[model samples]
Structure formats: C-alpha cells, structure tokens
Target: MNSFFARKYVIQGIFISVAILIIARLFYLQIIDDSYLLSANNNVLRKVIVYPARGVILDRNGEVLVQNEPVYDLIVTPREAKDIDTLLLCNLINIDTVGFRKRMDKARAQSPYRASIFEKQLSSRTYAKLQEHLYKFRGFYVQNRTVRSYPDSMAAQFLGYILEVNDRDIERSKGFYKAGDYIGASGVESSYEELLRGNRGVKNLMVDALNRPKGIFSEGKYDTLAVSGDGLVSSLDKDLQILAERLMKNKIGSVVAIEPSSGEILSFVSSPSYDPNLMVGRERGNNYMKLLNDPHKPMFDRPIQASYPPGSVFKVVAALTAQQAGVIDQHSTFMCPGYYSYGGGRARMRCTHVHGTTSLVHSIEGSCNTYYGHVYARMIDSRGMSGPKAYDLWREGIMKFGIGQKLGIDLPGEKPGLIPTSDFYTKRYGSTKWRSGYNISLSIGQGEMGITPLQMANIMAIVANRGFYYRPHLIKGIGEKKIVKEEFTEKIYAGVDTKYYESVIEGMSRVVNQPGGTGYSVRINGIEMCGKTGTVQNPHGENHAVFFAFAPRENPKIAIAVFVENAGYGGTWAGPIASMLVEKHLKDTITIPKYIQDRIFNANLLPAVKVAAPKAKDAAKVAANTTAGLPKSRIPSTLRINADFSPRVNEDNARVNPLIEFNSQVYE
Candidate 1:
C-alpha cells in the first residue's frame, strides 16, 4: 500500500509540471509577443518603392549628351478613392472627365484595393499644381521619379532612348522590375543597360484606415536606400557630330569619322534623321509611328546598316593584296589600251581615261580600271596556285582589312558586308568554267562586293595605322570609377606586311596632293591628306559618290568616309565634303572658299532620284536590255562612267512631268 501511494505521488508531480508550462506559454503569447498582433492588422501597413536616379551620358569632352529631370507618377487605390470630386480631380490633372474615367477604369482593372498608376511622367510644374489639391482626392498620391532629357539635341540613334518596361521586359527582369519601370530601348543606352540602371530600394510605413500615412513603421527599420546608376563618357566629339549632322541635313547618306589611334568614333551621321526629342514624353508613341511610316526611313541607322559597293576605293586593297601575294610591287607596270579585251574578244572592260603603260602608284592615282584588272588576275592566278586557291587567298587578305565581316562595333544592327568567295563563283558557274577573268570586275571594287560606310572608314583607319585597328566603339569611359572595357583597349592586327603599306599610303597621298590625281580638286593647302575617290554605280539612277581619307601622312588623327547617293563623280560631291570635314577638324576652322560650302549646302539630289527604288528585278532587266551581245561576265555590272544625261522635261508645259520609259526588251 505504501509503494502504490508513492507511484501516485510521482504521476501527480508530472501533471503539475505540464499545467505550469501551459500557463507560462499563454502569458508569453498574450502579453510579451506583439509580432503576430501586428501581422493580424494588414490594412495598417503600406510598402513604398524608392526609384534610383538613372545614369548620365556625356561626350568625350565631358559635354552633357543625356540627363534626367524630376517627374512624378500619379497613383490611386480605387477602393479607397470614394467620396471624391471626379470632375474637380480631372480639371486639376488637365484631363477631361472621359479621359479621367478611362484611366481610373484601367487602374481598377489592375487592382481595386492595391495602388496602380493613373498617370505617369508628370512634369514638376504639374506635380506642384496637383500637390495643392491632392488632399481633397482620397487614396491618390504622387511618386517621385525622373525622365530623360537630351540637352544637345544630337546623336539620337547612338545615344538611344528609354521607354516604359513592357510585359516581356518585366518577365525577363524577374522580381527586379515592374510595369511602370523604364528601361533602355536602343543604342548605348541598351548596350550598357546593366551598368546604367542602379539598384532600387523600398520603405514600409504605418497607415490609418483612411489610407493616410501615420508614421514610419518600427522606426524605419525596414527601409533601404536607392543607389544611383553609373555615368557613361562616350567617344563622340560633340562639335564634329553637330557639324556632320548640319552638313548632311538635305542629303540622304551616311558619314562616319573615327580617331585612328584609339578607334573612337568622332562622329556618326545618317541623313534624314529625326530629332531625339521626338522620342520623349506622351507623344512618343504617335511620333514613333509617324517616323516608322515615313518613306525615307529616317529611323534607319545607315552608317552600319546600308551596304554598297566600295567602288574604286577598293583599289588600295588590290594593291596591298597583290604585294602581299608576291605578284606585284610598287614598281610593277602594266599597259592599258583604254579597255581590257579578254575571253577571246567576248569580254571588254573599258576605262574612262586612257592610261597607257602605268605604274602601281599611277594606277591608283588615276583609278585605272585596266591596271587593277591585270593586278587582280596576276594575284589570283599566280605562284602556280589554282584559280580557286588563289582567289581564296586574295579574299582572306581583303578580310584582314575588316571587309567581308562586321568590325564588332559597340553599336547594334551592324551588317557583315559581303565578300564573294571562290566557292560562290564556282557554284554559280562550275569550277572548270570559271577562272580569274570571270571575276575581273572585283579588281575595281565592283561585282558581288558590298561594304558599309563604317567598314569603309575602318579600312581607311587600318591604312592610317599601318595595318591594324581597334574595333570601332562609341563608349570611352564608364562611371565615376573611370573604368573602360578591355576590348576597347586591345589592339587588332590587320595581318599584312608593314612594308607594303608605305607604297599604298604614298599613292593615297598623291590622290589628293598631286595634280592629275582623282582627288586633287579636294586637296587642302598644307594638310598632307591621303584619300581615294569612288564613283560607285547605282542601278537606279545617277552613280553614288564616295570618299575615304585620313590627314597628316605620318601620324593620322581622323579617318573618315563620306557617301552621297546619286551624286555623280566622287570628286564632285563626296571629295569636297570629306576635305571640308578634314580641314575643319585638323585646323579647327575651314580656310577653303565659301563657294564650295555654299554649293554642297544648296545642292539637292533627292528630287531627281526619289522615284528610283533599289529594285533587284530591274537590275537584271536593265543589264539584259542594255548589253545584249556581251557575255554575262564581260558586260560590266556597273557602268563606271560620268552621268551627264538630263531627265526628260515637258517643253509645252513647264509644270507637267515628263514621261521617259526604258523598254524592258530594248534601251532607247
């Protein structure tokens, strides 16, 4: 009986311990812990997003290219926005009642209890006016933000523009972005987005039942500060870019200038371009649609997108490749009988000027068609190599000069210009049937070759640097830390013998400085400029004019390429413009006569050639119609002669348009 009584006492002690533990837990939960109590009151908490300031963009000279201005986003919670004067609120925001209801309904569709944007990107003046009447409109508030502004009104394509993030952008960003956030859409703004967009922050505050902020929750313990983005220092020369844009105002083409030593683009201009400001604010969508619909394609980035035959400017490559391949040298000589007759008299390639027994230098100076044709044949059919092997070697040499491939510039939408391979010709005309003579047109930078203006400038840069160039880029520096990317710092070699470049350089110098040279008319007084003029054939109308040049023979500064569509001879239009730019950049002032400037500024070719679209169907038809008896290879793809024909005009009525038609079966 005593043992049983002891066991009972032990069980009673365990039960007493459990009862005390339960009482202690209840006191801790009800009296000491308030975390669960706060969570239970969800309507009293509010989360606010703090947007960081976007990065700024400046030119190489530290001139501001892009900046930001303070703006506000008007937000509203539909459920809490009751008992408000709808018409009064509409008048304060400068919107009609219908517009206000539309915005309200749009916001309500997103969420009734949660806050959504009713209006965004309001200017500081508008925000200030709305601030006075905000208290009268319940559940409505203003969120601080910034919008991009271009102070200089230039480099619209390269500087790029920003737009509100779409569903694709937000989904790609995961939790880092929302619908209202802005992101870079194009140009450098899009290329370096990660470095330019900074981290966002958040803050939590206590709110009353009326949706009014009470105070900072937990003494601001959950708040985080926003960090501003990194600034970018671009490689562009603001003054040069402005001048190029001004010069190209009435024309349709592209101009690209670069610092040969650093590969920094001094200027990039595409004519018929729209103002960057047109892409800003509420009218951006409408303006963008208009620009998109325009016939001239103002939004097109032509410097790196539009490709054209290099024309006679390609002779330098032929010369260098000839020397490198051990087929010709500076002293090589060839005779031209005004035309090169090959393929048993079935083929004839004519030269504009008779250049009989010419040296390598004279060939380039006069842009002798026969001379380069012979050299190209020798290079491609030399050293006992087969036609395919020899042609492949020549093409590889050409590619080294940054042709037939994209230069890997920092900008977007760069095209890899075409360089027809031996296989391409062999496939088109079987290996045994095709020979060096079948591809003679390539000697003078014609036929299947197409290169962009950027590539043209880069090729000139390679010549300026004695066969090497940094990949062309727009950005020079990033952030206050002054960091630059490694690719820009690295040097790329053009894979040619340095000794061969001197002769080519000498020939280029004479093209501008010596009399009888194609570019002699464009020579400055004492700049020692080296240049090449190209009169590229356009299937549509008048031939396109092109000029590529670099100044100061020894240590070149600026290397530029200018292209003027349907402008006839290169020296007539392109040469003068390029010379003017070179003179202005080197001397910081133009000493050339005012007559030259006035002529280029007043000249307009768009009206004459506006109706001629670049149609490939017409090219074959024109070729077949114009050269009936000549073999396909013999009939030159581009008639590289001066265009002196005038468009037909009505003699009876001055205002009546003339009708001159070319028969598809015959040329009249």
Candidate 2:
C-alpha cells in the first residue's frame, strides 16, 4: 500500500512539472521569437529597386558611339487593379483585349499583390496617352528605363548588342548584379565592362501612418548616388571608317589600316555590317539572327578570326629570311621557266607564266613564283637538310615576324595560325625521315601555313619599319588612361637583320614604282609604296584578291591589307583596292586615273572558268595558306577581266527609311 501511494505522488509531481515547462516554452515563443509576426506584417510593406544608367562609349575624339535614351514600361498588379473597362483600356494602349487578358492571367499566377511588366518600351505617343489617362487603369503604372542609342548610325561588330538581363545571367553574376541590370556583351564594351559599368544608387523613402510615401528619409542620407561610367575613347577615325564601309559595299571581305610606325589601327572595315542601334533593346536577338543568318556572314570578325595562307605574300617573308641567312642578297637572281624544278625527286612547281631570270627586287616586282620556289628549296634543303629540317629555319624566321602564332593582339577572337615546327613534322612523319621534297609548296607561301588579314597588315608594318612594328590596337583610351600596348610600343628587332628587309623593301617599291611591278597599275603618283600582292587561290571556284603595302617609302605612315573574294589576280583587283585606300589615307582622296578607276569599277572578277577540285589525299585538311594566282604577264595575258557587272542590290534592305522604320519606329 505504501509503494502504491509513493508511485501516485511521483506521477502527480511529474505531470505538474511538465505543465509548467510547456507554459514557459509558450512564453519564450510569444516574447522572444517574432519571425511569424514579422513575416505577417511584411505582407503590407514592399521594396522597389531603381536601376542605374549604364556608361557611354565614344571614339578617340570623344564622339559618342553608344549612349542611353529614356523609355517607359507598362506594369500591372492584377489584385490591386480594379473596376476596369478592359476593352477601353486595351484600345487606349493599342493592345487587344485578348492580349491584355493573357498578360493579366500571367501576372495573377505570379502574384496578385506584386507588380509585373505587361508591355515594355512603349513609344512616346503611347506613353503620353497613358500618362493622361493613368487613373482610368487603377492598378497599371509606368516604370522609367533607358535604352541604347547610336548617332552617325553605323555598327562596328565589336560594339555588341545589349539586352535585358535574363535569369541565367542574374544567377551567374550572383551577388553583384540583378535581372534588370545592363551588361556589356562584346567589343570594347565587354573588355572594359568593370570600368564602364558605374556604381548603382539607392533611395529610401519614409511612409506616413497610412502607408503613403511622405518624403525621402533624412533627404536620402543613406542612399548611394550612381556614378556614370568612364567613357571609352577608341582609336577609330570616323571619316576613314565611313569611307571604308561605303567602298566595301556588297563585298565580302575586310580592310585594316594602321599607322606603320605606331601600329594604331585607324580603320577597321567588315562589310555587310548592321547598325548598333538595332542591338540596344528587346528586338536585339531577332536583329542579331538576321545578320547572323546572312550568307555573307557579316557577324564574323574576319580580320581577327579568318586564317588564310599568306600565298605569295609569304614570298616576301621567304625572301627576307633568305637574305638574313646570308644565302642570298638583294641582287640574288633565280631563273624562271613556266615551272620551277625541285632539286631531287620532286614535282615541278607550275607558274602562271615564265617570269624570266629575276633578282630579289625583281622577284617581288614581278611576283615571280619560280624565284621564290628556288630560294625556298635552296634555303631549306641546302646542306642536305631534311624538308622538316629546312622548315625550322623558315619557321623561326616566320615567327619573328609574328606569324604562325598569336601576335598578342588587343582584339578578341584572334587566332594563332599554324606554322609547322620540326617537332610537329617529326611526330607526323618521323625524325630524319621527312625531306624538303615533302613540302616544297611551303617555300611559295603555300602548304600548311595560315594567317589572318590582321596578321598580314602587321607583317607589312614590320617590313615598312624595316624590322620593327607596334602591336595593332583599336582603343586609344578609356577616358584619360590610354590603352597602350606595352609590347609593341617599344621597338623590337623581330630578330631579323635590318639589311635583309631593305632588299625586300626595294622589291616591293619596284612593284609599285616600276612598270614591271605587279602593283604598278594601281600605284599612287605622289606616294612611293613598297608592297606585295597575293592572288590567294581558293578551293572555291574564284581566287581571292589580296594586297599588302605601306606608302611614302622612305618614311612610312600607313600600312594596309585588303582581301576581295572571287576576284581574279591580286594585282588586278586587290592591288587597286589597296592603292585606292593608300591614296585615301595619304591624300584623303582617290588619286586613281580615270581609266584605272573605270577599270576597277567595271571589272567583273567572279569565276570566268571553273577548275575541278583535284582529288588528292584529303585536300580538305590542307594547310590554310591562301592560293594567289597572278595575272598572266603582258606577253601572254589572259583576257583581262573588266568590271561591267554590279553587285546584287536589295532595295528593301537598303537604308532609304531608317528614319521612318528605324527599329524603334517599327519592331516595337
């Protein structure tokens, strides 16, 4: 009986202790933890973010290339919006009732109490209409925003388009950005994003007892003021850029001009370009699609990304290397037949025509393939050096000129074209196994070597300077700080004997000044230019015309490169273009004789004959060197092509109505 009584007392005491602990826990929750109450009250408060305006971009002269324009986005909160005549409201905004309903449904699904954009970037007329009738649509409001604008109105590919930040970008950028923030996507805009994207500002307003905004809290003492981004002053020249674009109309190629001594790129032209204004808003993706799908591939940065064999342009390099190696001199001569014979067990290299015995200068003047072929074989195969063995000396010399490798250029998408090394060949064919005969084409700037037009211009700069060149760059400064290239600013010898370049320069000068020079037909009168021309042969039907030159020979100013596709004979097509560009740069006008200009303007250099592609062991993967077919010598000239045909013109795509149908005026 005593044990039962003790058990009853212990059970009663335990029950009382449990009751007391439960009451204390409730007290702690009610007094100390306020998450539930705070969250409940938050339903009445809202936070809104005010985005900062992005920075502007300008040319070297402080001309605006990119800037912002104000616009309005129509927003709606379904639950707060009331007593609406849906049809009248839709008519007022020029949106259909069905469209309005669809948007409302979407907003309701997201959150009836939260605001969402219904229609973005409304026109001024529509915005004005909305402002006058805002009370009629109670829940609808307008948010101010900015869009991109371009003035002088041409687009360079590097000034990439901008768009609203997507979920993916917001998530990726994480803490530093939000979905509505603007970001630079390409060109200088991208490269200097951090500098160009200024700091954002915030404002906190105090509310009255009725939840109405009264005034800024302490005059926004805690708010951060937005700072405008520093402007990008580019190296581009306005007049030259416009002229290059106008001249390149309907052509599929590129032109690059630079100060030979400084390597400051003055004009960069890529044809079939679009306006940057098209990339500033919601329709950017659609506009980009149109340009991207264009058969001309205007979006591609050909100067930086497209690699072609230097063709006979590589001959200048070979000639310089040969002279530097002491294997030859300025007066060195080689006999030319219609074809060049390789020393031992090799096929004879076919030429367009026999150029006769020519010195190094004459070789460049006449662009004698036989001369370059012989020099290449002798230089590489001299002393019984294997083919790959000869390539090493050649490769090393080529590398010094910034070929077969990245020149450490400032632009994006630059390619380091391939220059075969002995190790590379040894791995492919075996040590002591590959002979000069294995790749005799390399001597003439053919075979496995490839280079871009930008590199081609850079090479001309080196040759013009007689052994040194600056690194090619586009931006002059980001505000006050100049984008100086530390590497090319200081002269580098390029590891070549200066005397060797003089001989090549002599040949190039003759090519322009002498009647026998391949470039003489298009040569400018006042300016003495030393340059090489290449008829880069194409796997496609017509050959690509190409030229590299620098003017005012004794003291050079401009170094240039031009490529015109499907245009026969570099001297005929590319030479004239290069000459015209040179004249424009030197004199700011076309100095071409009326007859020469007519010849150029009237020449139709598209395929006159279709040569069958030879089937030989995967020619598809052959080295990317461009094939250049010289115009036949005067003695046995092919019927010269004259420009009688005009490029196909599409009137709708032309700029007759940029004012009435500017993207802002249309796709909106």
TM for every model, in the order presented, reads 0.83, 0.78
Candidate 1 lDDT over 320-339, as tens digits, reads 87888888888999998876
**CA error at residue 80 for candidate 2, angstroms:** 4.0
**What is candidate 2's CA lDDT for residue 586?**
81
Any runs in candidate 1 off by more than 4 Å, and if so which?
A: 1-45, 205-219, 430-432, 607-668
Query: How do the residues 1-668 of candidate 2 rate in per-residue lDDT, one tens digit apiece?
Result: 99999999999999999999998888777787754444343334334445566667776566777787887888877765778778877877788988988989988987887788888787677788878777677667677777768886664665665556677767887757764567777666666677777777666655332234456766666777777677676677777677666656666677888887777887787655767777755567788899778766777877877887778678888888788787788878877875666545234656656767778877776777678767876777784666666677677877988888787656666788878778866776556566555566676666677888888898888888888887787766755565564664766667777778877888788878888667778878888988877777554445678888988898898898988777657887778877887888789899787786766655553333333443455333331222235433531112223213433322212111112110000000
Worst 10 residues of 1 by lDDT: 659-668
Best by TM-score: 1
For candidate 2, what's the RMSD? 13.2
- What local lDDT score does residue 539 receive in model 1, on the 0 to 100 scale? 55
lDDT scores in order: 0.81, 0.70
Q: For candidate 2, give the lDDT of residue 437.
A: 54
When summed lDDT is taken over every stretch of 10 residues in candidate 2, the lowest stretch is: 659-668
Q: How close is candidate 2 to the true structure, as a TM-score?
A: 0.78
TM-score of 1: 0.83
